[model samples]
Target chain A: DTAVSQTPKYLVTQMGNDKSIKCEQNLGHDTMYWYKQDSKKFLKIMFSYNNKELIINETVPNRFSPKSPDKAHLNLHINSLELGDSAVYFCASSRGVRSYEQYFGPGTRLTVT
Target chain B: AQSVTQPDIHITVSEGASLELRCNYSYGATPYLFWYVQSPGQGLQLLLKYFSGDTLVQGIKGFEAEFKRSQSSFNLRKPSVHWSDAAEYFCAVGPGSDMRFGAGTRLTVKP
Candidate 1:
């Protein structure tokens, strides 16, 4: 079984459209994270949630929102997606905020036309 | 600001050749270093991590990294690389609860 899983490995839509990517971790971890990889393969943290509570939030635009319904699930929803929003989004989980090991799921590549 | 630097953007070597990937990090406190491998269409897999103690850390798939606190460098090396080792490698430094990743170095292995 996959330690972390993501729905819709690829997402394609037009600019100004809204979309969502779902992620789940079977590792029973308490901390989850979201990262965005740009075209240059530069990965950066967008948000971190611990036990369904938001802990870290980067300078990401308000158009991008992260929702964690539970500790195992964290979803990314983009409103009025722009061309610059196209990138690979990754979901990761760790045993705790202080834990060293982090498990990442297969990324979801989002394309905005 | 905490940051991670990967010196080489791309590296090429023949199969069975020695491989080394350079990484440098800037953090205010003790640097928690990690190396991750990203294969095509797959998630990032941790190769190794250095929290403290021995500077030399061995990782899965026959990979190893040495952390140098003086130079602020954590370099990943392999005695002999396999064709399957061709992928993107990332160096990350964790400060507090947030981890920062480098731009990544793409490895090309020749047969």
Candidate 2:
């Protein structure tokens, strides 16, 4: 079984368009996270949710919003996507807010033209 | 604030050769360290982690890492590397809500 999974593995959209990526975990984890990997392969945390509560929001632009409908799911919605948004986005989950290990999903590659 | 540094951007090794990937971290309090591997076109997989027990931690696929508090380092090693071992390795530090990851080191295995 895939502990963590992401939908829409590849997203290609035009500039100014909007898109959303979905993530789900079956590990019964309470914490979920979104990360961005730039072309240079620098991975940075974008947002984190614990028990459906927002816990960490890095200095990401307001255009990007993360929503957690339930503890098992977290989705990212990007508005006005720009060329700079072209990169890989990863979704991860952990047992709790202080859990040491995180399980990651096969990232979604976004291309903004 | 916590940060991780993986000085080696890329490394190449022949099959059956031994391997070591360096990782250094900076944090104020006692840190939780982890090593994750990402194969090409795949997601990140936790190789091992160091919470508070023994300094040496064993992971899947014949991988191990030693956490040295004096040096603030957690280096991953393998006695003999296989071609399937080639991948991007990341070091992370955290015990809270936020985990900091290194830029990552890409391993290229030669046949």
Candidate 3:
């Protein structure tokens, strides 16, 4: 079984187009996260949700909003996407907010023209 | 603020040779350290982690790492390299919800 899964393995859209990526985890984890990997392969944490509640919000712009309908699902919606938004976004989950290990899903590569 | 650094951006090795990847971290308190590997077109996979206790921790796929608090370092090593092991390796530090990852080191194996 795929512990963590993400939708739209690849996305290509215009700079002004909006898009959303969905993520789900069957690990029964209470904490979920969204991470952005840039062209340089530098991974940065964008947001974290624990049991559907926002726990950590990094310096990401307001255009990127994460919503967790339930503890098992967390989705990311980008508004007014810019060219700089092109990167691989990965979804991860941990047993808890303080868990040391995180299981990651196959990343979604986003390319904005 | 906490941060992780992987000094080597890329490392190449022979299939049967030994391997070592260095990682350094800066945190105010005792840190939770981890080593993750990402194959081409794949997500990150946890190779090993260190929270406390033994400084030397063994992980899956013949991977191991040693945590040195004095040096603020956690480096991953293997006795021998496999062609399948060629990938990007990342070192991360976290004690809470926020985890910081290194820039990652790309491992290339030569047969």
Which residue pairs show backbone clashes in model 2? Answer: none
Clashes of each: 0, 0, 0
Interface RMSD of 1: 1.6
- Tell me the TM-score of chain B in each candidate: 0.97, 0.98, 0.98
lDDT of 3 by residue, A22-112 (tens): 9999999999999999999999999999989999999999999999999999999999999999999999999987845999999999999
Off by over 4 Å in 1: none
The TM-score of candidate 2's chain A against the true chain A comes to 0.98
DockQ, per model, reads 0.66, 0.79, 0.82
What candidate 3 gets wrong by more than 4 Å, as runs, is none
| Per-model chain A TM | 0.98, 0.98, 0.98
State residue B90's C-alpha deviation in candidate 3, in Å: 0.2
Q: For model 3, report DockQ.
A: 0.82
The DockQ for candidate 1, computed on C-alphas, is 0.66
Residue pairs with backbone overlap in model 3: none
